[model samples]
Target: MAELRLMKGNEAIAEAAIRCGCDGYFGYPITPQSEVLETLMARMPWDETGMVVLQAESELAAINMVYGGAGCGKKVMTSSSSPGISLKQEGITYIAGAELPCLVVNVVRGGPGLGTIQPAQSDYFQAVKGGGHGDYKLIVLAPASVQEMYDFVDLGFELAFKYRNPAMILSDGVIGQMMEKVQLGDYKPRLTNEEIIKRYGSWATTGKTADRKRNIITSLDLDAGSQEKFNIKLQNKYKEIQDKEVRFEKIACDDAEYLLVAYGSSSRVCQKAIDIARGKGIKVGLLRPITLFPYPSKAIQELLPQLKGILSVEMSAGQMVEDVRLAVNGKVNVEHFGRMGGVIPTPNEVVEALEEKFIKA
Candidate 1:
């Protein structure tokens, strides 16, 4: 039987990582996300499962540690907030270039500099697009609540190993800090050492052996043609993911005339907004994307043929709205409402914005 428990998002992630058979975790403490480290520390998976947990000197070191472990075919992970993630970009690029499997969690915070410790969605573009200087994409999963935070660890690792690429859990401070009821999913171990050796043994530097060739994992391509070939492979993989890996949630969309598109914590706010709109006899619905990178474009496009308008409520200024617009194909009116710099809007605020901009003529 599966166990149900009340946990904060950060705690859930730590628990899920252990249950998922994650081989190692390397991270430093950062606000809003510091609880992840604390939880993992308290659990002490190292003593029980022999899983390695290290608090690196910095975010850069933590990510590099992840790269080191992944290169050895270990199910590794790292977590940080926005600024710490910014520092991990270089390491992320390195991991992607090497076609390694690892999980990264970014509990977002405000801004370009030393932003506030509060939540912000400003990292949407960074997470969806390549944060580092490269032609690469990370499998980005956006979690709306504490349950998804736990659920996403298994999902993240699965996607990473499936594509031989890095995967990220793109959460924010609110989700990380909020307490919620979560179902501790069935304890299913992801991969055995024997399985790892059988599948990824050719490249992973487990040890030197006379039967195998030396492996050098790197992104350095001297020849343009060689670099292009690598890029082509990555692009092909991304296309496959786009086609088969997208996941999202739809509420009251089948009979709705107006739709609200949002993700992460903002989607929760939109849920409240939908309830308010319905209370006033306005026919509104919601489409929440769980996989932000393999965005629910097809779903949005399908909705366009039936819905009259879409209001995208986000915590960023307007990053996701552009994607919504493109998916709609100019078939219907699409508008945006947002707040930035770590300011979370209340349900009433969202309702008023919807009324002024979308519902009330």
Candidate 2:
């Protein structure tokens, strides 16, 4: 049986990390997400689980710590808000280059520079489109509720290790701070160091052994042909992940005339708007993204033939609207409806936007 408890999204993430047998956590505090660090500090997973949790001097230092731990072939993580996460981009790129598995959480907040501490999905592009330098992708998971916050941490680690890549739980202010009843599941660590090396030692830097020569883990392929080959392999991996890992929720989309595309906190509002639109006899539905990086493009394409148009409701100006456009492929129109800063639009506002943008047409 699953145990039920009221938990904040941030607290659930900390607990999930312990359950997943994460070896280390390094992070610097930032608004709308400091509670994650606070919960870990109070719970002290280090005492019982032998996990190392460090409050680094800055987000940059925190991510570099993840880099170091990942280099050791250990399961590790770091987290922060938008500004702090921005600082960690260089380290993120390096981690991807090394093909080291790790988890990163960006409890997103609005921003071009020092954006508000309020919840926002403005970082959608940054998370999915590679905020760092280079052609790399992170396995970005967008959690719409506190329950998802707990659930996706373990899944994130699994995906990261499986691909020798990084995964992110892209959350927002509402999910992080809001308290809700969450079903706590298993906490056993899935992979051990010996097991990890056995499974991934083809490239991981375990110590040189008698049976074989020294091994090096690096992203550098000086030979152009080798680099291109390496890129092709990565592309194929991304394709495989798209097929197997993309996750999303569809509410009445089968017959929906006007679809609301949302994730994170915005999805909550859209949920209410869907109900309200239904009450008014408007055939509205929702497409909530659970894995933002994978983008749920296939699902969108599947429903494209049925949709009149998609109204992308987000906390940002319109970060995710572009993805909706790509998925719809001009078979149907896509328009964005959102509020910037910290102000969450009311259900009425969202419903009205849907009516004007999609239903009226």
Candidate 3:
């Protein structure tokens, strides 16, 4: 049976990882996200489900550990905050280059460097626009509530392996530390080595046998032409993801004259803003993008006919707003409103920005 408990968002992520049969978790501690490591340590899934949990020496080590595990077709993941995630970018790119499936959870904080340990969505470009090198994309999921934080862990794994690429749960300190009631799923047994071999033998680094040649995992090519072909293949996969996997939610959009675009915790705030706007006879709605990379550009374009303008509300220095502008493509007025350095914008503030940008302007 499923269990219901009041768990912090970070704790819910850990609980969901264990319950979803994660083979291993390798992570280092960072504020707002440290509970993920702490909760996993307290739960000790190794004893219950034979899951392997380790406190890596650094974020670099943690991400490389994920690479090593995923190469062997294991369900692996890691968690960190801003600066820590920056340290792991090289390994993250290596994993992407190698086309390994894994999960990376970034409980984002403010920064271009170690800015603050508070909640912020300033990592939008890093998470969605490829912080690493070469050409690659991670399947990015933005969870707006605690329940979603719990749910997206398994969903992240599912998409990672399905696409044979990395996936990220891009959250912030607000969701990470906040406590909410979560319905935890039943425990799922970790996959045995034999099951892994059986499932991914064709591509994974399973053992060599007389009947089959050994599988090699790498992202290197001595020939430039060969590397170009490989890059093309990756681009094709990304195109497919864009087509089939764009996820979003539309609230009160049918009769809306203006739209507010936001994600994660900011979207939650915008919900309240929508109510306040509607109460004042303003027909405003929200378009919350759940998948950041496979963004809801089309959804924004679809609502263009009814909207007089669009405002993107976020906790950053206007990152996602660029994408919103591209999607609108000069068809309507688009603007950005945000707060940085860990300050969250309030509902009224959002409305004020909306009115100021679209109404008063």
Best by TM-score: 3
lDDT against true structure, model 3? 0.94
- Global CA lDDT computed for model 1: 0.91
lDDT of the candidates, in the order given: 0.91, 0.88, 0.94
TM-score for each of the candidates: 0.97, 0.96, 0.99
Judge candidate 2 at residue 348 and give its lDDT.
99
Residues 1-361, candidate 2, lDDT per residue (tens digit)?
A: 9989999999999988888798899989898889888999898988878899999999999999998888878889998999999999999988887888999999888787997988888888889998898788999998888999999999998899888889999998889989999999876854667886787666667787787677676678789998888878877887888888899999878778878999888888999998999999988889998888778998888887777778999888898999999888888888999998877889999999988876666
lDDT of 1 by residue, 1-361 (tens): 7798999999999999998899999999999899888998999988877788899999999999999999989999999999999999999999999999999999999887997988999899999988998889999999999999999999999999999999999999999999999999766665667787788888887776788888777888999998999999999999999999999999988888899998999999988888888999878889999998988999998887678789898888888898899898788998889888999988888888878887676
Candidate 1 minimal-lDDT segment of 10 residues: 185-194
Per-residue alpha-carbon lDDT of candidate 3 for residues 1-361, written as tens digits (9 for 90 to 100): 6678998999999999999999999999999899999999999998999899999999999999999999999999999999999999999999999999999999999887889998999999999999998888999999998999999999999999989999999999999999999998877788888899888888788778787788888888989999999999999999999999999999999999999999999999999999999998999999999999899999999999999999999999999999999899999999999999999999999999988988888
By lDDT, the candidates rank as 3, 1, 2
TM-score, predicted candidate 1 vs. hidden true structure: 0.97
RMSD of 3: 0.9
Top model number, lDDT:
3
